[model samples]
Target chain A: MTAKIALSDVHKSFGTKAVLRGVNLQVETGQSLVVIGGSGSGKSVMLKSILGLLTPDSGSIKIDGRETVGLARRGRADIDHQVGMLFQNGALFDSLPVWKNVAFRAIQNDGMNESDARDLAVDALKRVELGPELLDLSPAALSGGMHKRVGLARAIASKPEIIFFDEPTTGLDPIMTDVINHLIRNCVQELGSTTVTITHDMTSVRAIADKTALLYKGEIIWQGTTDELEGSDDPFLNQFINGLAHGPIEVEGQKLDSAASPIEAV
Target chain B: MTFLATIGTFFLAFFEQSGRLSVFVGQTLAAMLRPPIYFRIIGQQIIRIGYFSLPVVALTSFFTGGALAIQIYYGGNQFNSEAIVSSIVALGITRELGPVLGGLMVAGRVSAAIAAEIGTMRVTEQIDALTTLSTNPHKYLVAPRVIAATICMPVLALVADIIGIFGGFVVGTQSFGFNAAIYVQRTINFLSVDDVTSGLIKAAVFGFIIAIMGCYNGYYSKGGAQGVGRATTNAVVSASILILAANYLMTALLFSA
Candidate 1:
C-alpha cells in the first residue's frame, strides 16, 4: 500500500546545530503515527518539514508519492488545503472570534458564506464537545484545555485528508489530557485521516497512536506498534517510558548507563 | 587597514539589509496584485488605519497651524509687517506642516499598532497556520493594510490642510486682531492647487512608508515577545525616519526651480 506521507533522509539544520540530521519515516494511509521525542529532538522540525513550513536541507518529502520539498506556492497551497494542524499553543487568531477561528479555512480559503461557515464551525465544535454558546467569544476568554478543544475544532472543521497534532496534551491536567487523547483518536477514526502527532506523553501516545516512532537526537531510533513499544526490552525506551533516572539516554551530553544508579534524574 | 575593513563590513551589511528589504517590497507588491484580493479586510483596515486616525491628525494640524501663525507674526514684526501671517501660515501648513506632521503622527500611531499586531501573530505561529490553511499571509494580512494606508493618507492630508489653514485663520482674526475677510482672502489667494497637491503626494508617500516598514518589520519578527517588541520599535523608528527623509527628497524633487 502506498504511504500517505513519505519522508526519506530529511536533513535540516540551523547554523551549526543539526536539528534533523537524516530523518527517515513513512506514515501509511489512515494511520495515526505518534512521534515521541525529548525536547529539541527535532520532532517539531520534522513535522514542520512535512507541513512545508520549513524546507528540508536535502532529502525527499512526498505527500501521496508527489515531491513537496521544493513545491511552488500554488502547489504547496493545494497540498496545504488537505492538511489540518493543531499547533502546540493552539495559535488561534486572537483578533477573530471563536466561530471565525474554527471556520477560518472554510471562510478564508474556500470562500464559503459567513452564515454557512458559522453553521459548519458550530457543527465541528459540537464534534469536539464544545458548545455554540462560546462561539462568539475571543480565544482569550478560554482556558488552556478549552483552547485546545477549540484548536481541535478548527483542525477537524474542514475534514482535511491529513491532520497534525503538536504537543496536544502538554499543559493539560491528567483527566483533560486523557480527554484530548481520546478525542484525537475519535476524530481520526471518524475522518479516517492520516495523522502525525508529536509528543513525549506516554498516555497520549498509548491512547491515540496506531504506530509509534521514538526520535532521539534527530533520528528515529525505534518504530513499531504501541504493544511492541511497551513489550520491547530496549533500555532507552524503558528509561523514557518509565521516566527512569538511569539509562542509555544522554542528559546534559552525559550518558547515564542503565547499570549505573544515578543519584537523581538531573 | 583595520579601519578600512570595518568600513567595508558596514557597507556590506548595508547592502545586505537593502537587498532583503527590496525582496520584501517585491513580494508585497506581487502579493498585492495577485488574485483573491480581500476587499473586506481592506475596508476593515481603512477603518482602523484611516478613519480611527482622523482625530489625532486633525488636532495636530490645528495646533501646528495656530503655532505657525503666532510664530510668523512675531518674526515678520521685526520687518514692520505682520500682514504676511495668514499667507505664510497657509503656505507653510499646506506645503510642509500638514502632510509632514500628519505622516509623523500616523507613523507613530499606525505603524506601531501594525507591527505589534502582526509581530504577535508571527511569534504565535498564526502566520504558519494561515499558510497551512491555504491562505497567503501577505495577501490576507499585509496587502490589505498597505493598500488601505496608501489610499487613506492623501485623504487624511487633504483634511489636515483645510483644518490647518482654518486654525491659522482663527488665530489671525481672533488672537492677532486681523480683519476676518482679509485673513480668509489672503489665505485663499496665496495658496495654489499645486501646494495642496504636493502635500497630498507627500502624504501618500509617507503612508506607504508607514505601512511598508510596519509590515516588513512585523513579517520577519521571531523569538517570541522580545522579538515582537523589537519589531514594533523598529517599525516606528524606521517609518518616522523614512517619512522625514522621503519628505526632504520629494520636496527637493518637486519644487526646486
Candidate 2:
C-alpha cells in the first residue's frame, strides 16, 4: 500500500543557510513516526513544508499518492483541510477564548454554528481532561500545560486524517511531558490517524513512536522501530539518543578531537 | 569595492521590498474581490478604524482650523479680516488641513495598532494556525481592515471638515469679534463641493495606505517581540509619509485645472 505521507529528496534553504537538504521520509497510514532532531535541525521547517506553510526549494511531497508540491491555492487548501498541526509554542489565538480556539476549524471550515461548535469544543476538551468552565477564558489565562492541552484538543477536535506534532513535550516538566506524550499516543491511536511528531526528547519518542527517524544536518540519517533505536549502535544515533557531548555529532562551534565514544547506558 | 557593494545591496534591497509590497497589494485586492467577505468583520473594523478615531481627528481639525484662522488674521493684510479669516479657514480645512492632518493622526493610531496586533499573531504562529484551519488570512484579516479603513476614512474626513469649520467659527465669532452669522455665511460661501470632495477622496486613499502598510508589515514580520516593535514603527512611519505624499499629489491633481 502507498504510504499515507511521503517526502522525497526535499530541499529547502533560507538565503545561504541550507535547511532540509534532500530529506526523505514516509509515514504509513495509522503509524506514528517520530522525527528526532536537535534544535535548528530543520524539524519545524520540514513540518511546515509538509503542512504547506513553507514551500521547499525543490522536492516531492505526496499525500496518499498525490503530489502536493506547487499545488494551486484551492488544491493545497483541500489538502490542508485534512491536516492538523500542534505548534511547539501551542500558538493559540490569544484574541479568542479557549472554546473558540478549539472550535475554530469546525466553525470556519465545517460550517458548524456557535452552539454546535461549543458542544464540540466541550467534548474535545473533555478528551484532554480539561473542564468546560475554562472554555470562556482566553488562552493567555491558561498555564503552559493547559495551553498544550487546549492546543492538542484543537488539533484533534477536527478529527483530521493526518496530524503533525512539533515538539509536543518540549517545554513541559517531566510529569507534564509524560502526560502530553501519553495523550498524544492515546489520541492518535484512537483516531488511527497518520502522524509525524518531530522531537529530540528520547522519553517522548519512546512513549509515542511506532517507528522513529533521526534527522541530522538536514537529512534523515537513520530510521527504525523503537526497539531497534535502543539496540542500534550507529555512532550518530547512539550519540544523540544518549545525549553524549563526545560523539560523531559535534557540539558548539568545534568538533571533539576524539573518536566516536561508546553509547552510555541510560 | 566595499562601498560599491554597499550601494548595490541598498538598491537591491529597496527594489526587493518594492516588489514584495506590490505583490502584497495585489493579493489584498484579489482577496477583497473573492467570496466569503466576512461582513461582520468589516463592520467591527469600521467601528474600530472610523468610529474610534473620531475624537483624535476632531481635536486635530479643531485646533488646526483655529491656528489657520489666527495665522491668516495676523499674516495677511488686516483689511476685511473677518471675511479673509473665515473664508481661508473654511477653504484650508476642507481642501487641505482637515483631510491631511486627520489622515496623519489616524495613520499613527490605526496603522501602528494593526501592525502590532498582526505582527504578534504572525510571531505567535497564529497566522500559520489560520492556514491550517483553511481560513485565508488575506480574507479574514487583511480585506476587512482595508475595506473598513477605506470606507470609513472619507466619512471621518467629512466630520473633520465640519468640526474644523466650527473651530474657525468659534475663534472668528468669539475671539475675533466677527458676527457669528457673517462668519458662517462666509465659510458656507467659500467652501465648494469640489473642495470637500477632494479632501474626502484624499482621506479614502490615505485610509487605504494606512491599512495596507500596517497589514503588509505585520503579515511579513519575523523574529519576535523586537520584530513586532519594528513593524509597528514602520507601519506608522510609512503610512504617515505616504499620506503626506498622496495628499500633495491629490492637491495638485484636484486643483490643476
Candidate 3:
C-alpha cells in the first residue's frame, strides 16, 4: 500500500532540550494510525512538526509524496487546506456562534456565501447528531462533550482528505469517549480518508485504531496490527500493556528484589 | 561573558519581535481594503476604542492644560511677561502635549485590555480554531481594531485640544485678571493650522502603534493565563514608551521647518 503520510528521521528541539530525536513513521492511504506515549514524551511536538507549526531541525516530511519541510507561509497554508485538525480542548471561537465556527473556513477561505455556509454547517452538525436549534448558541454554552462534537464537525466540514486528532478523548467520561470513538470511526469510514490520531486512551486505541505505534523517548519503539499487539512477547510492551510497576521498566530505577531470597529457610 | 551574552540575547529578541510586528502590520493593512468589510465589527470597535475612551482623555487633558497655565503664569512673571499666558497655554497644549499625552493615556487603557482579551483567546486555542475554520485572524480581529483606533484617536485628540484650551481660558480669565476676549484673541492668534494638523497626525500614528502592539503581544502569547497577563502588561508599557519617544522625534521633525 502506498503511504499517504511519511516522516523519515525527523528531529526537533527547543533550546537545549531535544524533544523529537530521529522519529520515523508512516501512514497508508485510507487507514487509521494511533500513536501512544507517556506524558512529556514529545507526541504533541511530533504532530505539530508534521502540521508545520514547528520546524524540524533535520529530516524529511512528505504529504502525498510532496516534501513539506521548510515550506513558506503560503506553502504551509496550502498544506493546511488539505488537512483537518481537532485540537484537544475543542478550541471553538467564543465570539462567534456555533454555526459560524463550523463554517469559518468555507466562508473565509472558500468564499462561500453566508446562507450556503450556514446550510453546510447545519448539515455537518447533523452528522454528529447535533440539533439545528443549537446552531445559534455560543460554544461557551455547550458541555465538554458537545464542544468536542462541534469541533469534530468543524474539522470535517471542509471535506479534507486527511485528518489529525490531538488527544481527542483526554477528559471525557467513558461513555462519551466511546461515542466520540464511534463517531470518528463512522466519519472516517464514510469518507475513506487517511487519519493519524495521537492518544494515550487504550480504549480509544482499541476502538478507532487499525494500527498502533508505541512512542518512547522520541522514537517509535513498537508498531503492529492490533491483533499483533495482543500476542506480542516484548518485555517492554508487556510491562506497558499490563500497567505494571515492576519488570524491566522499573519504578524510579529500584530493582524488583525477588522474595525467593535464601534466608526463608529459618 | 554571561552579562554580555544576555545583552546580546535581548537585542536579538527585540529585533526578532519587531520584525514580526512589521509583518503583522503589513498583513493587516493589506486586508483593510478587501471586500466583505465587517462594518458591524468596526462600529463595535469604534465604540470600544474611541467613544468609551472620551471621559478619561478629556479629564487628563483638562488638568494638564490648567496646570500648564498656572506654571506659565508663575514663570512668565519673572520677566513681567505674564500677559503671554494665553498664547503659551494654547501653544503648549495644542502643539505638543494634547495629542501625545492623550494617546499615551488611551494606550494604557485600551491597549492592555485588547492584549489581555486576545491573548487569552489565543492560549485557549481559539485562534487555532479560527485558522482551522479558514478564517484569517489578521483580517477578522486585528484590522477592525487598527482602523477604528486610527480614525478615533484624531477625533479624541481634537476634543482634547478644545477642552485643554478651555481649561487654560478658565484659569486665565478668572484668576489672572485677564480680559476674556483678549485672552481668547491671543490664544487664537498664537495657534496656526500646522500646530493642530501636526498633533492630529501624531494621534493617528500613536493609535496605530497602540493597536499593533496589543495585537502582536496577544496573538503570540503562549503558556496560558500567566502568559496572557504578562503580554497585556508588556503591551501597555512598550506602547506607552514608544508613543512618548515617537512624540519627541515627530515634534523635532514637524517643527524643524
Number of the top DockQ candidate: 2
| Residue A2 in model 1: lDDT | 74
Lowest-lDDT window of 10 residues in candidate 1 chain B? B129-138
Model 3 chain A: worst 10 consecutive residues (lDDT sum): A257-266
Each prediction's RMSD to truth: 2.1, 2.6, 4.0
Worst 10 residues of 2 chain B by lDDT: B74-83
- Which TM-score does chain B of candidate 2 obtain? 0.98
For model 1, residues A1-266, the per-residue Cα lDDT tens digits are 77899999999999799989889999999999999978888899999999988989999999989999989778777788889999998999999999999999999777899899989989999989998999999999999999999999999999999999999999999999998998899999999999999998999989998999988998989899999998999877888899876777787677777666666433
Fnat of candidates, each listed = 0.88, 0.94, 0.59
Model with the higher DockQ, candidate 1 or 3: 1
Q: Candidate 2: where are CA atoms >4 Å away? A: A259-266, B78-82
Candidate 1 CA-lDDT value: 0.92
Error of 3 at A257 (Å): 11
Two-way DockQ contest, 2 vs 3, winner: 2
Which stretches of model 1 miss by more than 4 angstroms? Answer: A252-266, B1-13
The most accurate candidate by lDDT is: 1
The Cα error of candidate 2 at residue B176, in Å, is 0.6
Clashing pairs in 2: none
Residue-level error in angstroms, candidate 2, position A127: 1.1
